[model samples]
Target: MYKKETRGMDIHTFATDGNQEGVLAELEKGIFVDSRNEKGYTPLACAAKSPHASVDLLRLLIDAGANIHAKVGESQRQPLALAACSGSLEKVQVLLDAGADINAESPSGYTALLHIMFRLHDNEMLLPMAEFLVQHGAVMDCESQYRESPLSAAYLRRRWDVVRFLLDAGADPSPLRWSKLLEAVALGSCHDVKELLRVPGALQQRDRFSRTPWLLAAFVGHLDKARLIHAAGIDVNEIGQCGETALMTSASIGNPEMIKWLIGVKVDLELADEFGQTALTQAVQFGHADCVEILLAAGADPSITNEYGDKPITLTTSEEVVRVLVEAGEDIGDVSTEMRRILIGLEGSSTLRVSKSEYQEGCQRRFGSSNPETMDVPFWQEMIRTGIPAYESKSQFGDLYEMTCVWCFNRFGASFTALPDGRYVQIGGEHEDYYDPDFCIYNDVVVFQGDGNFTIYGYPQEVFPPTDFHSATLVGSDIYIIGGLGYHGSRRFGTTPVYRLNCHTWHMEPVTSTGACPGWIYKHKATLSEAGNITIRGGTIAIAQDGVEDHVENNEVFQLDLTCMTWTRFAAEP
Candidate 1:
């Protein structure tokens, strides 16, 4: 029980602690039953989440006018969802009996059924509670805002029993929006895969990214499922939307077994994809020595070059792969110095370091266009590392000393916004101080997908200049980039710079604004309100006065009403 001397203890604490007597005392004292705590959980939400909560205690709170219909916290979870998530059937029954909406959705569109299967624990009541909810009219195929259904959630949790139950309960194995067969294959569920394959036309379906079940099976090293898919009549050498064959996919992922099987089945070894890379080149570039040897033994060519003029030996840094290729009559003199350095870095845990000239030249040449043919670089969209060193002054015995500090791009003040489709966008960032020779502010956008693939996008100077220390707020389908410490002579007084990048088309356009401006600001924060206003606060603005830069701390808060593209200043009240 909470002591009376412990003053300021409210009904929320009592509800959280499951103190029935303390809650009654607070109720008698006339405390608001629906008042929220710091984390936005009300008294009922607090009680619903408490493991020690009783049905009678919850009934008392509801009797005291606690709202069963209320959704609380950042997730906006209902009391029924909270009760269901806590694995308490009695609490769930209490909330449902008190008129809680069983199918009510959270902000993310998670129903009570979805919330129970979200984060799986070893609680024995979870499956029973799921069954109870399903019997009580919970939608079994209900999807969240991210299009993740309960069946997919069950597959993600690897609850085969729950999966079997959902499948037996007649959950749709083939949803039009996404493929359940491919998901089952990716998750390595043979039973679910077989069940999903029974759906008509499931074998011939392609996902939104144009990936087939055969390609996914190869990518995930699921040879068993690959054989099942092959038996289901997806030809072993069929090309995907990007002209990607299963042999190239196997080689790229370093699956020697899959490569051997594809070789045994007579897949075309020299067939180039849209990138003009054969199975041998993919194996060598990814440093798969075993796969390389297998491909070479199976009469794969090493002397052939991709569209970027990079041969199998030229793209690889592995001495083993190089030795295998050299023994197969490829000249050792063909390997470039850059590839040799990468080999040296791969010998240990040390990072692969490229000189500033090489790094800049690579970015300029490769990031010139989004088109793979136009880029003409070997490591386009591949794993890359470029470290830039910055010298920092340190105090030693009241004297300043310089030390080198290495920082990577996007490790600084870069903006990362997650897209709706399980991918994210990384915008421009700088390497070091503006005065340093290594200092470079990037004017690029890189979108990374869930499947470990990324695309680098470049823009002209006027469209989107080099940016860093800016806020990229996702408002609807557009990401608004506002305020940054750009290059010298870039920012001007009396104007707030704002640019909107469409998430779909990747097009960037500058936004013209009206009203009072927080001029030339960086290192600030911007947040979107529910009413379509972007509130920016707490940044430094620089003023150039007679060749000296004066930095002023911006204390005033500003709001941009996105509806009108107008700014308003709010002064601090004393």
Candidate 2:
């Protein structure tokens, strides 16, 4: 064992000392040239990394059975990687010539060429060593564990020449190429855009959100890039997946400067999105007072109702917005009195107080009991039959009380359904992974009512869609949910189901069953503006991947316009 250790150290010392003669002579003395020291370093690795060692020493070590492929560190520390990171061009060549794996990776997944490009910042030999690694089959665009490419790293390091070299070798920078024009505009990096556009097929680039280069540029107020894109002849008013023109997008986010720029260029101001909301209405909905003022100055009509018959003024309660609309010849009389009262609470009014939740009630509620459709489990059905008390000890809201389980009403979108027989019912709501012992994690379609305080009827039906922040609006004794965010049948989305509950009879059923609602959303403002219009305004579109919440950017304003009690989705707000 002592002989083996001594042989390893002797060869390592000779290799690192640039003693080519000693390295050869040690082999003649039967010292194992490739033996590793305590640091796991072979003699060839030490020689390759030694700044004082000549190429001849490295060659002698390789010729004397030194391991070219032997790695030293827990990570990559192979002979070629060591030579490459040191920018030792001659040693790198020698190791490659002796059949080292050019693409050999460290334990952390860095390739040899990657080590060279990553470490030698501010060194004049960076480009040359980089070129050498690529010539010897080192992947120029090799990715690390974080999926960072060589081009991305070089760009981040401001190594312009290295970035250009990597591009020249066909290193496709998917991250940059994906958003070259947009990012250039956003960062005001006009000087680098030319090289970015030089990337093969750059002109045809679109972002992951499918926004064209010019749209992003204009949205960020970059007129120079906008002009460049406009010169390319793409439509400035072209609509995106969100159904927004650059003008509307700028208007939506309240970029008055961008809006003015777009207006100066004579883009269409009257172009409404698929939702029938003009740029003026979008600005109003988002409370962009500046955008609204600007659009109104640009001759945007305030009285122009969206598809929902709601004027721009109806989307906002802002005094500034109201002033703008009134100045633009809009009448305040167009808003319903109920809406006005709701906006400003009914303080000391003569209107008789309805049920605490606003559902109409009466003495004799409708028909016989519904034999609930078979869906819920028998155990839950038995529990429902027993009922939970509305007032475990005492009632909080009114004299009337109902014996009902909290399970039916403890959901996200669930609300009090007013019954004609002086009672109320709860249909559905939403919940996630909650650990409460008393309440079930999810709500069922079991019936409950405030009829003495409201009795909890056990699970009567298995609801198809779930309720997560679904909106509820009451018109007389009929309670309606506009749309909800959850699974429909099996697929989850921002689904619009015309769910109607007769507080009179306590019977709930699908009314329209055909209105193709927008994507799922929750916490949006939905209101029955008048007789038949249910306006659903700005909300987060509910999107989930593997049951984890996904980002929602849809500020969609849609409405369900009812005709003879049936509903149709309208691209309007009223």
Candidate 3:
């Protein structure tokens, strides 16, 4: 019978303490050999994982009927897995000779061979263990519930030595499913990709999503794999779902190497997506300046527009991009035939039910009437950098020389509200002080008359309305302003106070109703629809410099009915 003194401290405790004779004595007393500690470790498990564990102690525990396959950790690692994880070759051999399950997996589905491969910091160590396991009936494939077999898993984990060993051992040379190849490319596994390509007919395989490995590789700018795929007899011009070709994807992701390589291979340059957006349009939209230059030099037609009537130049305001397209013989300020089709197709409530003939007349009236084109030297003038106008003419335009010049733009969040008659209102935003060289902030407005002059209209001196990221939409002579960040008493806050500037009346009015405003936010886009609904969409709340988050996520699309100036949430699904 077990001694009463030994009852207080169980066999697991003896194993954890490395008391081999005490553990053997307990086994002699017929104490339950598989008894556990609070950490779910059996006595044999404690002994095997102990830093002080002896090879003889492990052998004795197995000789005493300790379940060698008993899993004993949070991940339920078997004793042999633990031995492999600990890099203990002697303990591993001892368990194997005593008939330990060499192929046993942890709760996470990692086998002894996998743990050996996983624990490896040195490849030569893994080379021996991997070879030993294969000789002892460990399955070479070693597939796991995580959807990776031993070969792909080693490849995915970047274990090249194990990967090579597994490949030499005839690891199923296929990444047969979407998840396997998806992991390979998405995680940047270039080494194993060479072997993955050797799978029978691997080039024609598509994921469940019908995306080839080439497509996914392009999706993330994985240029090495893309180059490899192109060389491996797969066409670089292959189109995936949504008509996403490799060249278009290269432009979309802004990968210069992929763009250059695809161009060198003569991939289609003018191929548009499902939405009729070309690679040039994609490059311009995402502000890839170098790609835009390359496409232009490669003879890409920079004059093309998308289905939304946005030409390559319209997608970006970069001067470099504009110069590239213009140099390629694309006129800067002209509407192409594509945009004319879009304007001619506009009807119904979208066009506010205007008659087709009248709309067509307006379209002709508006297109290319006031393009800012340059003339010959000594008469040429161009808008450059800021609002500061430059003139190259020998004589100045008549009234422009007499107009007042006000420096109106160290300003952010200001609205440039355009009018039908070619005049515009520059509404309120904060500006740095004009007097103090260091500059203070204040709320103000300016009015531009488009003949090279503007008038500064300062707000009330008693109130400094330093609104942040506000939006101003023009409706007739009145400009509606709503939802922006504000500052007062050294604290920042979101403001919902709605206001209107009546230019015709020469006064400001508090446009108020209980439901007249979307909750306060910053950086939102506001537009005046023809139906008198002022639609507000997308902006984020401001936080303090130390980042104390005090806000709500404003995701609902709101429309303020301008007739009543009442706020209402509308469905954004179109």
Candidate 4:
């Protein structure tokens, strides 16, 4: 073992010292030239990495049958990659000439060129070594496992010269991958961006979220890049995926100069997002007093309200912003505040109340029943049994009282149906706004028996996710649930969403239907006819228009044939 260790170290030492004579002499003795040291450094790898090593030394090791592709250490460090890291063009050339793969990667997926660009920090020989590697057919866009290409790595390392060279060498700056144009805008580099603009459709590139390059400039307050992109034919008032204009983005970031630039460019300050938030509203909500003042001075309407009915003054908590809004002839008080006060006042006020027994008596009077247990059982069952009536829970005392098992009536867009065995079933629903913490889309089946007994059954998320605004029509023993709004991330766009719930076992299963299915519909009516057809009518369907989901009112009637489970759409008669 000791002899083997000594021989390995001798070859490695000779290789590291760049001693061509000693390495050749070792070859004459027929020694193992590919022997690895304790650091897993073979003779060829050591010689390739040594700066003092001549090209002949590398060639001698290669001629001696040393592995040119031999990798060492846990990183699987290749010999050619080590030579490239040394910034020696000749050593890199010797390895490449000796059948070394130019683009061979380590276990981490970094090629020899990527290693040189990423590891070198302002070295004088960086460009020459990079040029040498590139000239030899090194892939400029070969990405690492982290999706970072050679050009992107250089860009991230702030190597502008290398970035320009790589760009000139025809590296593709994919908008979906790491975007050089967006990065230049972020760095506020107009010169670099100007040079990059020569690429066709450079200014028109958008990220995955549909954020334009000009919009990114607005986000970072880079007026120079914004002007560059604008001059290059990019729209200054480009709207993002959420309908947010560049002016609104600048206002939200509290950049007064960016706001001033946007205003000077004649951007539409009144443009609102999907939430109806304008630039002034954005500034006020983020408490940017300076931005608010600038926007108002630029002829922005101070009275503009969002979809939530919140204007600048109503949304702003900043006293300075409020004063600015007031000086601009805006309303002084918040309407929401007055509404909140009214609700608070009602919270303390008392209403004429009745005892539970009196409420039961009133229920007995209404239903003509003598049993107290059966009286005022919150008659949700009776309403579904007959027809919905103008019914309120009140006793003969003319006041309301709480029931033993309080069924919350706060559900909206939920399914409530009467089962065949005299059981009432209530399906999934949400309370209020989807953004609210309490706004939960329930997937539980609330079963109300005829004997005033109720049970809540829950299914797995995969079986029944949070559902709402769908139709639950009873067809035989199975309840066929048609389309509704689920979570945005879980929405299936191309086909209709159908599920079946067995009333007997309460088991839920998804149904995959075919043939011209209604794509993502809600607020629709589903009816089971005697001919075993479920006809659907008058619902809003979510259709992807220009990559954005648009809800269009669908008046066409679609019938689902249960036998084959297919949908057939036909024109609805006026």
lDDT of 3 by residue, 1-574 (tens): 1122334247877786778888988888878787766677778788777767788889888888889888776778888877766667788899888888888887677888777666664545666777777877888776668765666655544455666677677777566345455547655478867778777777777753456888767775788888777778877778887787888878876888888888998898998888888889888877788999888788888868788866686666555665576567543333232221222231112112224343223211011111111111111111111222211110123323422222223344555554556455555443343343322233455454545444544445333354546777777787777766655353334336577776665355567745635565666767666788887877765444456656555676888887876777665721
Q: Sorted on TM-score, highest at the top, how do the candidates line up?
A: 1, 3, 4, 2
Clashes of 4: 0
Error of 2 at 110 (Å): 1.5
Question: Can you give the TM-score per candidate against the true fold?
Answer: 0.39, 0.34, 0.36, 0.35
Q: Which sections of candidate 2 miss by over 4 Å? A: 1-7, 182-574
Q: Compared with the true structure, what per-residue lDDT tens digits does model 4 show for residues 170-273?
A: 98766234367876775537898898888877777776557678887776677888888888886677788789889998888799998887888899989999
Better candidate number, 1 or 3, judged by TM-score: 1
The superposed Cα distance between candidate 4 and the true structure at residue 423, in angstroms, equals: 90
The lDDT of each candidate is: 0.73, 0.62, 0.63, 0.72
After superposition, the stretches of candidate 4 with alpha carbons farther than 4 Å from their true spots are 1-6, 175-574
Best by lDDT: 1
Task: Give the local distance difference test score of model 1.
Answer: 0.73
How far does residue 117 in candidate 1 sit from its true spot (Å)?
3.5
- Relative to the true structure, candidate 2 reaches a TM of 0.34
- What residue pairs clash in candidate 4, if any at all? none
